[model samples]
Target: KTRPVLDLRPLPKVMADPEQFPKVVTNLLLNANEAIQKKGSLIRVSTSEEGGWAVLSVADDGCGISSAFLERDLFRPFRTTKKQGMGIGLFHSKKIVEAHRGRIEVESEEGKGTVFRVMLPVGDGVREDG
Candidate 1:
């Protein structure tokens, strides 16, 4: 099992669906875990504030993803790299983020690693880093 390194930073509150938002975190973590192809790999989960957005990022030093798949099929339903995956996790995660008026982004390099970032606007219109 690969253990995740956590860097949970404090941030201003954001408007989010309590139930749906958690699924996004869970799905991203699971995907990161599954991507590991070697022992002693690292998965880092972190939170921070950037430009009035509350960001939650999950990064992994795992098998990574192909540029083609990352660009064309990442957030699409039923597209997956896993043999047993049904592939709805990221699809629903994107929907949930968008529903909260947020956005999701990804960066991956095959044989290197991958990172997924979820960003939502600050609810009270406060900026943590001014």
Candidate 2:
């Protein structure tokens, strides 16, 4: 088991539900953890601000998703390769992020790793005092 490295960069505030936003973070981290299949794997969580957006990225040096699966079934509910998975994590995550007017993206390569990025617009509900 490998501890995740966090690079929590300063980010502009976005309009997000305090209660629901943590679920997005938790689900992404949990999904990254479940992807690891061996010892010494690494998971990285990062935050940043880009072009008026607050970005949160979770990356894992674990089993990558197949290109076919990534295209067709990645966000479909109830479609999973894991024996214990119900395949709703990503599906639910997408709904939550989209509800916040944010977007989620992914990049993966077979035998390499995967990276998931969530970007939220940084304007509405943002405090200028900070």
Candidate 3:
């Protein structure tokens, strides 16, 4: 399979913790890559705007998360599908988004794909450069 690709969309200025945001994205991207076991799988990252917020999404074409896992406490610390995983990625990601007054959402199907969307407010008082 090809390496995961990131499609960063143009975005408006927003206040964010520069240090933490990239880590959040990286974690998600890494997780997506790890999920794919064979060639031809794809991971896409994109951005957009909606309702006065900057929306970032990372999508992967791989074995999707189960409905039970999605509905349960999947984001809880130490909860993970991987035997060696600590299950803290989503939990930490949610905390980072919330710290910026944003929200983290997920969409997935059993065999199709999974998408993680992060929405952060865009406006004055936010530092876009960082």
Candidate 4:
């Protein structure tokens, strides 16, 4: 499978903590790469401004997550599917997004794909850069 091809849209400038935003996106990209079953697997990233929100999404066309894992295990402290360590990336991402008055949304289908969208409030006066 090919890593997801990106289809990024122009995103508006958002009022955000520089450090936390980068960490959030990096965590998502890492997770997308980890989900890949092969080099051909597809992973895509996109950004947009919508209805007072700055939306960033990372999607993978790899093995989709189980509903149980999505519902119960995800975002909980100390829960993990990896062999090496506790699953803190998602938890931390969630916290950071919420700290910025944002929310994380997830969608997945077994054997199909998964998508994680981080939606942050865009200040009323923030303008587009390009």
lDDT of 3: 0.83
**Candidate 2 lDDT tens digits, 1-93:** 676899999887689999988898999888788888642389999999987789999999888889999999999999987889899989999
Q: Which stretches of candidate 2 lie above 4 Å from their native place? A: 38-40, 125-130
TM-score of every model versus the real structure? 0.91, 0.91, 0.88, 0.86
RMSD of 4: 4.4
Clashes of each: 0, 0, 4, 10
Q: Which candidate is the best by lDDT?
A: 1
Alpha carbon lDDT of each predicted model: 0.89, 0.87, 0.83, 0.81
**lDDT string, candidate 4, 26-90, tens digits:** 98888878777532288889888888788998998867788999999889988876666679999
lDDT of 4: 0.81
Q: Once model 3 is optimally superposed onto the true structure by TM-score, how far is the C-alpha of residue 85 displaced, in angstroms?
A: 1.4
Off by over 4 Å in 1: 37-40, 124-130
For each of the candidates, the C-alpha root-mean-square deviation to the true structure, in angstroms, is 3.2, 3.9, 4.0, 4.4
Ten-residue segment with the worst summed lDDT in candidate 3?
31-40
Task: Return the candidate ranking by lDDT, descending.
Answer: 1, 2, 3, 4
